[model samples]
Target: MSNEAYAQQCNVRELMREDANSEVFFQKYTLSEETAARLESIREMLKDDIAQANPLWKVIAGENEEEVYSESETSNNDDESNHNESQMMHDQLVVPSTQFYFTQTERTFVETSDTSAALPQRCDILESACESLERNNGRLDFVQLENLSNEDLIPVVDEMAGKLSLKGIYNLCASMNNMTIEQKIKYLNVLCTHLLLPKIIELEEPSRLLSSAIVECVKNFPDEIQQFIFVPLLNAELKDTMLITTIINSFDLEKKAILLEEFLAYVKELKSWHISILQNFLSVRLDHNMTDKITKLFSGKALYYSKDKTFGKLILSFLKLNTALSQEQKNLMVEVVAVNETLFKRPMENILKNM
Candidate 1:
């Protein structure tokens, strides 16, 4: 081959090899097209850093090539150096391949009292409440809270619920001892409106105090509590058994029955832990009517809980609670109970004979 033709052939082969390596690098890194574009933009932004680290740039800028050589330079130093420089330049052109996951802002206990000066002037009630509470060592004066109208109290409660730490909530609950039932209900409504249950439940030491205050408030205002509290608590995506039990136990028997019925209607939408709670309630609290309702609800879906003997036992236990079960319900109970007779220990024949 002619010298020039041979050179052209070599150049084409080198280009093909470089393209193949680039494709493999992209596949290995799983770089999407959009991500690759973003990386190109970042590379453009850091062009100065790339140029400084680039050996070709050093040569172009009139730096001595030998000055860039390391002590590890081989006997084939020219070829090795060229290859190493090319690889470094290629790496500089691509984005770092480390998987980037989005992170939430670290939760630090911010001192709202210290930052009170930065609060908006419009939040006067909030500002006053914080200052007054802080001055009294976090004890809220009932008279002071009572004097504020719903309009004023709401903003203050919202500010505290949103910004205060668990310690602050504990302090607030301590002061609530002197609050009237009406005032306590109002304050709790504000907290619930702002969806603060997760934060309240997170308070390991003061959770009982917080839960007690909430339960008391809920008891006083059960008629109006759903919109402000129970609805928010139920929809908070939390699996906190303590919180759920506290709320449920606060309700009267009639309300508790209604709540359980509502929960059963939407059982399929609930998390497993939530369903377990309902099962627990049913095991102990189910009455004749409630048992009948549940029997009808699960009549066709017996197989759903068939694999879980504990659940089957819970269902069968409902039968023991009700002696007036219809023949249909009795039959359904037998089917469910037979699936897990080990839980009952007694023979199925004897249990059926008593029925």
Candidate 2:
């Protein structure tokens, strides 16, 4: 065999022996200089062959081969054709650029619906709500109020008294601007019955939460609506006294007198505290025409039913202090004090002096 072939065979045999006996016992041996040199050359040839087989190794090896070629060409008189061959190898090892293809679909235009326009009108909602309530015998309770929508409850908002939530009442109030006169009348009536009067009578600090909505409604309407809608509601058995202040502060003097008289008409039945508070709020000047109406509040039956005659005296004092009262009305106030003096159990000295 040639010396190179023999060296290759010996290297293969030595490797097999080392792997086979590695765990049992390691054996050391030396090769001749000629065999070692030949074996090292064969190893370099095998390394190049393995590297060229791998794509990544081919790229690294290609760069190294180009550099070696450049140095060899610079040192030696290598032909231009050989340098071209090295560049060709580098190009062959390079990864090719890939082209991507995409297809765009046509854009679709969807028709969006207008939800507000699709909503049922107020009349239709009322009719449906009426049918629902009729099925339950025209009754509404807290649970029913919770389940019903605002649009359904607005028409029958009066029946929602004491059952509706404050948020629901406010939601209804927002819709009041769009309400007809009759609708607003009924709404304010419900508000008085359920929210405003109870709070006023209980002496709760007037809630802007409740009063603001009512004031907004009333202030927006004309005199006829005020008289026909608000005055009667204020005069109704349930009195929201704070709203009286709202009216007196908001309306002209003429309208204030008209509305004040409406409230005075119900004075006999009102709580004494309401009477006292309201008497001081009179913005219009007192005349003899109002005396009969005013003195009637301190009538025999009024004092008889009165738990607090001092309230009656206080009310009388308010009348005496009225700079607007004529001398004749002042005498009538003194006579009311005299008639109630036994029940009042207080000196008439102040009442007499005020007169």
Candidate 3:
């Protein structure tokens, strides 16, 4: 064999040996010079093969496969060197191009009834592939759909996304935001239940994972647990408490009423100090976000007290107190009144005379 052939044999043997000792090699110097150089050379060769003018190369260039493959069938072979070179080029071309996605037209053709031999097994493979891709959205590719028909396969995306568990569905939906608008609507489930309150309330995920889940939950699931899990973990409080206060403090008077059960449940579990934390959040000249949440909370509380148990009676009870208003205390009450005069609307006699 020529020196180049010897080198090819050596490379193959070396690669085999490397595979045998791969774990140890990786542990010691996995990212070292030799491995990287070989990998880069392989990549460059694959690129060249993809850019070659051979018939398979032409098929990949958007030509008709029948026309391309018909030409490949008649190619004249001359020598071992030529044969090996062709094999090398073919291998390089096929392997990397697998990363390119099949065109929509091509996919449609494969999935058609004309391809029945492939339809059953191919359909399964396509579904498994889609399910796999939906799980790791960023890493999926079109070429992976090589065996399946595109027309049939595309329809299955909805089913694939739907069939996934809530966690999987969350990931699929979350992945949509990064895609274009059409892509987003395509992957998104229009009837998402967001039943996250039960799921997240009970399970404690890690911080990074929890944040991602929270983000996706907010985008898709608007259920009660969104409030419960959105809280920032202050000291040891269920971060949901902080999130609840934030949400309550930001809602319109309307949404706060609808969400009263969640808010009351939030406060019920909170310590007096945390409730104080929420109360303190209210008695201030604040920005719009804080203002909205408090306005809604107080208004909703007023409504809630009329229909159910809430902080409204506590407000009336405080209103009925007889303690002489200290200057500092009066100033604070003044601040509260500045936001909503409804705060001091009750007669002082109804409060002080009874006290």
Best by TM-score: 1
Residue 26's C-alpha lDDT in candidate 1?
64
RMSD (CA, Å), candidate 3 to true, equals 31.9
Q: What is the C-alpha lDDT of each candidate?
A: 0.59, 0.53, 0.46
Best by lDDT: 1
Q: Write the per-residue lDDT of candidate 1 for residues 1-355, one digit (tens) a residue.
A: 8999999999999987897789674675676799999877765644455545555554444556786444225435877889999999888666443212111122222445446545444465566656655543576555555556666666666666666655566566556545677766566556556535546434444367557756765655665555555554554465455656777777777787777766655444434345445654653466566666666655545556556655555555555566677787788767655555344535443666697
Summing lDDT over every window of 10 consecutive residues in candidate 2, give the lowest-scoring window.
98-107
| Residue 40 shift from truth in candidate 3, angstroms | 99
Q: Model 1 scores what on Cα lDDT?
A: 0.59
How would you order the candidates by TM-score, starting with the best?
A: 1, 2, 3
- Compared with the true structure, what per-residue lDDT tens digits does model 2 show for residues 114-144? 5454555545544443344344223222233
Which ranges of candidate 2 are over 4 A from the true structure? 1-155, 178-205, 222-225, 228-230, 233-240, 265-270, 300-302, 305-313, 323-332, 339-355
Clash count, one per candidate: 0, 0, 14
lDDT of 2: 0.53
Residue pairs of candidate 1 with colliding backbone atoms = none
